[model samples]
Target chain A: MNMEVAHTREEDKDLLKVAGEIDAYTAPELREALVPLTEKEGNLVVVDLENVDYIDSTGLGIFIGALKSAHNYNGDLKIIGLNERVHRLFSITGLDEVIDIGEEREEAK
Target chain B: MGDAYLRLQEQYRKILNQYLENKNEQGLYHAQQFSKKVLENQISPEEVVSLHLSTLEESFPDIPKGAQDSFEFLLEVMIGYGLAYQEHQSLKDRQRELESEIDVAANMQQTFLPSGIPEPEDLDVGVLSVPASKMSGDYYHFVHDENDCLGVAIADIIGKGVPAALCMSMIKYAMDSLPEQRLQPADLLANLNRVVEQNVASNMFITMMYGSYDVRAHTFQYAGAGHEPGFYYSAEADEFEELSAKGIVLGIKRHAEFREYQRVVAPGDFIVLLSDGVTECRTEQGFIEREEITRLIRNHMHLSAQEMVNHVFHELEKLQGFQLRDDFTLMILRREV
Candidate 1:
């Protein structure tokens, strides 16, 4: 399925709320939207994957690259609102250990 | 008349031999230089053709009556040979240029790697890296923070050669620019993902493992971006386990997330990180299992970290007949109580 990203700014962080399936074909669009946000020095970024139905390896890669970019500027990127399946995917791949995933939906913000 | 014809034939034979053997511009130029001699000797193309026909007739006395046709064919063959020789020379020159370009790129890639492994207090670290070809798609790095926190990263680009090298450099620069506050493994990878997504081509991706070990806390915090799972050796249990973290590869999506995992390392506990080149080592029976790597590490566990890595590499190399099919990187982080 096609992916959609909704962007907003909250406090000092760039909030990107993404919905839809993220796979090989649609991951680039998400990358295009998120790359510029990480470029600014010390820009706090938050990604809400609550509505994301599926995430493949490609989609995961984009998030990792974005996190690196933010860190380069001394900024931070946090992921919040991962659904059960998505969280399980992270556990399976062992990415749960590498990124900041907010367990409670309220804590994500 | 006979003497002059013999002299012409001998000269033509000598020129043909020179051109065929050297197959260079100089040889062709010599032939051009001798063209004037042919004119001065009043020898026509027909005379040359006749000389060739006579030589053929000597070998086949009962030859067919198509002497003139045979001469024409021979002339065409010579012209074709000359053209092929020039094409071959140009191709060789182009190949040489390409080889040199790859050499330069390979050298540049090397500079991006850490010149020497850092030896932090109370920690033993070792690394071994080998490219499958002149260039590698794998990269490993180490950064020490002011608080004595050591950050280790091992990454693999999706492809090899110049593009992969360029991607690796971007990773290095991004890591270097990371702010102190963002030194956490998860934060570091998140920042790096943005850099990679923006700079790296859409067709390419990267897998990485970034970990930070706090000397005082004795905790190892790490994150993985679709990279291969490393191995963890727990001295208390005297067993080996997989250091598996979940994250996707870099450059695939704009807003993705990676989960971080942490473990408290005790004395005699160590972590081993490696690229797929190590786990995917090919055998006649297919890929070597992940357990093989753990076994190798276990067998050499008594040695120092560096020597252990060396021994594992040597043994794997022996298994593969000393030929690596992919970029190989192995790293070890051990704590001494």
Candidate 2:
């Protein structure tokens, strides 16, 4: 029910490695950890969903909110390491096309 | 209504008079029938108790105080029960009226859907949609324009009931008004998004997949607005690959973009589109995986497109113990040329 976010600073971006289910109840914690990283101008934020097992629509909504916040400051948000289940959520909601679902090196374009 | 109440009172009085006169089996039968009439009219228990006391007074001018005290005790208990019973009856009447309205809306929803499957050349298109409840939260629309184009859309509203039906109506009208060229998958989804975002509430969200089969080109171009990912079966590989596009659910953002996807179909290839009800179908063992659905489709691949679709539904329905938890929709478009 609760998600854990491990923040690791890289060259110019913040990597938020996440674990546990990202559902309605646990999505806010992810939003808090994720949105602030995008608030700073041009900060590239990446969420590693490798450990995530499941995510409901509310979690998808949070990603949308975070994507909006990141874009507002000309910052970029990318998600990588989506397992099959989480990946299916992105594919189902068509978010995979909107958000960058790729590796850390595949940043910006 | 007033006259009916008066007639009911008169009948109750007559039945009581006959019962007090003979206390016979025939009188008892009349009393029982009158009790049923009182219930049918939703007459309160207090009315019956009061009528009984008054009838006793009239029948025996020298009625004893003991009998009178006993009537007062019954009246005291019936007062609370009578009020509750009347309130319950009122609620039942309101519930019945609500159901009637819902039935009308459900019929309207059915009428709005495409009456017959479009018989496009060289394409075997099969569609199946069943609602778990009276009003389906899922909707499918088909548009076969004059330009050798077949457009299909499948949508699922997050919530059900009247609001979902209204949204579906909006989608139906919007699709009807769209020009043929604008019926392309991505364009249609984007246009629908603008319409829904403007008219619908913030909380209301819809997921849709819009696909068009270009008959001459043998291409299926499709797009999604956070709908369930569909599948494409490659004849050469004999494998079912999921088809997906990038987009958010509709009515979320004003300027959300939907990514379009395309697949060129060779002879014997097919595309499968569905709602989450198919992917997330649950049984006593729990949710049957999408892979299981694919297996079922593969097992029934020899049947005609429509039969295959129906076979899968009945199979899923069986696995679900004949109780579908959500609206089930599955569509298949096969290239027969």
Candidate 3:
């Protein structure tokens, strides 16, 4: 998957927009982008998965990794802009409860 | 010429006899060296024929003409050695192609697993999902939210190989699109059931379990959809009880309502979630039962989470006499205050 990060000077929030299929092959690309932001600024990191066309367990693992990394830093990561496809994945896995996810990126935070 | 040819013929006979004695081992080493040095140079094809004919005539002068055709027959036999080398190369090429295909499939399967367990609060969650084939029929996912609520699932799609994996991706998509339902496990599954039934093939169905755990409430609400009844081990009660909520498998029918089961996970209480791969895990001996599983868990209850899981897998291996016939997926959730 392709990833692009947009961080504002608001001092607490980092927005990341990901594109492509976030299955086992492209998950690490997302993980590498998210894990560092968790350490540097700590968890107002909002991941936009709306542009993500496809995802599998590997992508789910990257979300888990980022969530853990943010928690370890005493902050939290939230997911936003999940299309119907991405949203269903979180729901079926019941991940919606584990990581804060929403239809909008702002609401996820 | 006469004396030299006699000496060469005698040398060839001695080497051939030696080669026969060793059957191409120690004697062939000497025979090949002698032939390369002396036989190829001093012995022409016609001269060697004459030498062999003279030797045979001396030994069997009264033999019939049919017996005297042995020299021509030996030349034909020598050409087959080159053909055998070419046949060996053909077999090697086929073997290499098979190995390459297996490598590609294995790499694809590896992409399906979580790199590691996610970090969450007051809970120890560990999962083990392995396939016995290049592609597995098993899959799992875990999600933890800021409110300390966690969602966990383990699924085994029916069938094996690429078809099962393709169905698994569809199942995952359905699960991902599920919306928040105000802590209703049953509704969560019912929604998933509708999504799966729409997308999957007629022959495919998935047995799965989905759970939502609230850390503050310390309660676990979960629903099962045609999966085996896994256990919720109560350290406080000192016993294990089945956590069963059976319904029709997703993708089998639309409007299937999966029942939900709930329990307050006290500090020291946890649940075990599994796919049928664990229960129906077959061996040459027979199928493993819940009693045997409980005994093994009790034996290794004190081990670390991952170690405990490994011990259970080892038991499964023993049952199969050290060969797994199916994918095995297990999830252990332990709550801690």
Quantify how close model 2 is to the true structure by its C-alpha RMSD in Å: 7.6
Each model's DockQ? 0.12, 0.27, 0.01
- lDDT tens per residue, model 3, B142-180: 767667788888887765567677777776667667765
As a TM-score, model 1 comes out at 0.64
What is the descending lDDT order? 2, 1, 3
Q: Would you estimate the TM-scores of all the predictions?
A: 0.64, 0.72, 0.58
lDDT of 3 by residue, A16-103 (tens): 8776677545666677777888886445788877667656544665676677677778888888888766675566544565588965
| lDDT of each candidate versus the true structure | 0.81, 0.84, 0.71
Among all windows of 10 consecutive residues in model 2 chain B, the one with the lowest summed lDDT is B175-184
**Mind giving the per-residue lDDT tens digits that candidate 1 earns over B1-337?**
7787788777767766677678999888877876777656655555555666765566557877786577778776666555665677679889999999999989988999999888888999999999978998899998887787888999988655676778788888888888756467877788888888787764568889999999878899999987888999999999999998878667655666778999999999999999878986877775587899999999999998999999999999889999986788999999986
Order the candidates by DockQ, highest first. 2, 1, 3
What tens-digit string does per-residue lDDT give for candidate 2 at A2-72? 78989999998999999998865787788788888989899999888877777765577677778878888
Q: What is the lDDT of candidate 1?
A: 0.81
Q: How many Å off is the CA of B232 in candidate 2? A: 1.3
After superposing candidate 3 on the true structure, give the runs of residues whose Cα lies further than 4 Å from its correct spot. Answer: A1-109, B1-25, B28-95, B177-184
Interface Cα RMSD for all candidates? 5.8, 3.6, 11.4
TM-score pick, better of 1 and 3: 1
C-alpha lDDT (0 to 100) for residue A96 of candidate 2: 74
Where in model 1 is the C-alpha error above 4 Å? Answer: A1-109, B1-69, B180-182
Q: Could you say which candidate leads in DockQ? A: 2
